[model samples]
Target chain A: MRERSDDTLETPITSMIDIVFLLIIFFVVTAQVDKDVVDESITLAQAKNAPAIDAVDPRSVTINLNKDGKINVALQPMSISQLQQLLLAMRTQAGSAIPVLIRCDYETQFRHIDRVMQAAASTGLYRVRLIAEATGG
Target chain B: MRRKPPEQLNVPMSSMIDIVFLLLIYFIVTAREEVTEAHLAVNLPAPGVAKASENKPQMMEIEVHPGYLSVRGMRLPIQEIANTLVRLGKNDPDITVLVKVNLSARAEDLVTALDLCSAANLNNLNVVTLK
Candidate 1:
């Protein structure tokens, strides 16, 4: 018969601590902290060579154009005038050099987008970017 | 002096704790999530090396709907579309072509319009969707 010895029993505290540290490192490395302001209902064109954009800057504003030709800012529908007003307010908040990013659907009209651009230009917003997919991966 | 066994030696956990804390801080500082912005869904071809120039006003506009193709709202035939693009390209090498296609427009229709633009060697093409 084999005799069990209490002296041989060892608490796995050190191993448990090591496992906790590993978990922390794993989460730290794999966590996705950046999330898009706009919803996925808006399908953006895929460009294999699109320039890498900086998302940490709070000065960038995203405007979405739906398939129905409706304009929405962060999922809230707004008129051109309203959009202009909101953009102007954002410009003021961002202190003069605000970057406006417009993401429109593939079926949106030029005139509609042009009007939005015109509004941004008139508001004295200089950094206007028309987002497009870079071709040919 | 008597020597102790190697397995009985204690590891200095303080240093390891400091490392863990430093790692935690480093992750906290650099762990910002990537923000994805809205965009159009299209495959753009790789652009060859060309001299950059100031953007100019758009001269030619091509509209693509489900069954018809129009140039500046004027309905035109497929053969004429390519011809017009070639003529316009010859007139102004810096010409800006605005391509507006409806959402429900067929992929073939969009491709045909793009093909016409390609045949004309028009590089400054701006594609917009008709909402």
Candidate 2:
């Protein structure tokens, strides 16, 4: 009778390591995309009933409104007109279905958010989303 | 004669695989899928555009004050606003809810009002800035 070789007992792990590396790379890439569009400095409001968006449109614009009513898009601070222009440009490219996500500090006055919404409305991009903390924080 | 183990098997990948799995778990936990952030969707009226419907819907306006919320000039606390909105929504789910947010009112106040509106399943919501 032929003896079983020890080499045959070793599991083929090379493919598993490859798969793990791919998964890690995928997660790393997706985790990073939000950093550029979402400003970490702004503290979002807390809400109990807002629906969670499962898939955010790629063409969606994220606007950060600070307590002082300043507007930041992609981390670059801009005036309301500048925001209008950006929305117009996006509207031209994305054809008016462009979703606008607003992230504002809890203490930020409503006027700031209103201005952002008005800017979006004027640009014919009326799909506005107000971002809030889901945990009621 | 006993066969010797191959020298090529000296570098075991089990330890490396363990570290890779740890990294994968870290990334999985840290990945911000934006699920932590809830969203309230609003469809704003396009500028210079009028509603096509001939019938004007009954609009319920809620003003966000610094300390409390107001419905049709009646003052109510933030916690109590939800009950009023829920009652209105019960009457008509399509009732237009106009949130008139005071310029000095904190964003949290407006959010709370909208939260209540959403909770009531009020679909027609319009946010207008107070003059």
Q: DockQ winner among the candidates?
A: 2
lDDT of 2 at A69: 92
TM-scores vs. true structure, each candidate:
0.45, 0.76
lDDT, residue B11, candidate 1: 57
lDDT against the true structure, each candidate: 0.62, 0.79
Tens digit of lDDT per residue, candidate 1, span B14-122?
9777987898788688655433432222221123311121133546778988778997788999889888888988888668676777766743355456556755767
**Candidate 1: stretches off by over 4 Å:** A1-33, A45-59, A69-82, A90-99, A107-118, A121-137, B1-58, B61-68, B72-91, B96-131
How many clashing pairs does model 1 include? Answer: 20
> What's the interface RMS deviation of candidate 2?
3.9
C-alpha displacement of B5 in model 2, angstroms? 3.7
Clashing pairs in model 2, backbone N/Cα/C closer than 3 A: none
- What's candidate 1's DockQ score? 0.07
The TM-score leader among the candidates is: 2
| Tens digits of per-residue lDDT for model 2, A9-30 | 6655666667877897787787
